[model samples]
Target: MEEKATSATFKKETVQRLMSLHFKDEKTKVSNDALILISELLKLFIMEAAARSAKQAKTEENELVSIDHFEKILPQLLLDF
Candidate 1:
């Protein structure tokens, strides 16, 4: 079976604004391709973080995911990226 690709979850204007803010010192424009790439990265980062946090919660036999679960996985998650 072929794996399905995930769509970009963020909007172009949001990514564009973020890029502009990041480069506030030097005015610059983000290309359409780069915008899509960054939006995908942002989505992946959040998804991975949530997945890892949920697993952490399951490990401790918790039904609902919480900030503590997220905190536990944060260090390793940041390192992974």
Candidate 2:
């Protein structure tokens, strides 16, 4: 959907801007490989969360994913930490 695409684009831009600011503050050179790896990791996390949300909604009476659902699930996810 157009909204998803727009949100993705915004997230990408926000990450890039944040990374730039982070590097500027640290004043330490970040290799291209490191940046790429971080970006990919973020994307992976976003996708995984989205997939889980969809799966959970489907299994739970076709309900839509909501912030409240995410909040309820997040504590369990942190058990590994």
Candidate 3:
């Protein structure tokens, strides 16, 4: 089956602003392709983290995923990053 293209979870302008803030003192400029890649990577990371969090909640017999679920996955998510 073919995969469908989905809209990115992050806004391009927002990502650009964040990048600027992160490299405020640096003279280097971020390229559009690099920005796009960063946004896509961020979306992928969020999706994976949420999925894992939901699984963890289910495994623990919780009906709803909560902050604790996300906290539990933070270390793993950071490692993935």
Candidate 4:
């Protein structure tokens, strides 16, 4: 439980740097609210991907989750998203 909560925060500076890369202005300033929203969305995406991959592995009677499992579910997962 604690681990899940702890993973929610992303590096603010890295996020800001990535955002700047896409924009024309290198001096663009990002608001904390916008950064927070992006962070939450990123966290949600990672969690959902992990859960789906785990489910695929379990259905195959495998305890270990692997890239193959993720690849199998990737198509439908993208559609669902």
Per-model TM values vs. the true structure: 0.83, 0.57, 0.83, 0.77
List the candidate 4 regions with Cα displacement exceeding 4 Å.
1-8
What lDDT, from 0 to 1, does candidate 4 have?
0.85
Top candidate (lDDT): 1
What lDDT score is found at residue 80 in candidate 3? 76
Worst 10 residues of 4 by lDDT: 1-10
| Runs with alpha carbons beyond 4 Å of true place in candidate 3 | 1-5, 24-27
Q: Clashing residue pairs, candidate 1?
A: none
lDDT of 3 at 21: 86
RMSD of each: 2.4, 5.7, 2.4, 2.9
How well does candidate 2 score on lDDT at residue 66? 77
- List, residue by residue over 1-81, the lDDT tens digit for candidate 4: 354455456888878787888998777789999998887877777788999999999999999999999999889878887
Whole-model lDDT per candidate: 0.88, 0.62, 0.86, 0.85
lDDT by residue for model 1 (6-62), tens: 764899998888788778566577789999899989998998898899999999999
Q: Write the per-residue lDDT of candidate 3 for residues 1-81, one digit (tens) a residue.
A: 565677756888888888888785778688889888999988888878988999989999999999999999889889978
Q: Write the per-residue lDDT of candidate 2 for residues 1-81, one digit (tens) a residue.
A: 333432342245556667778564666556666666677777666665666667667777667897665665666555622
Clashing pairs in 3: none
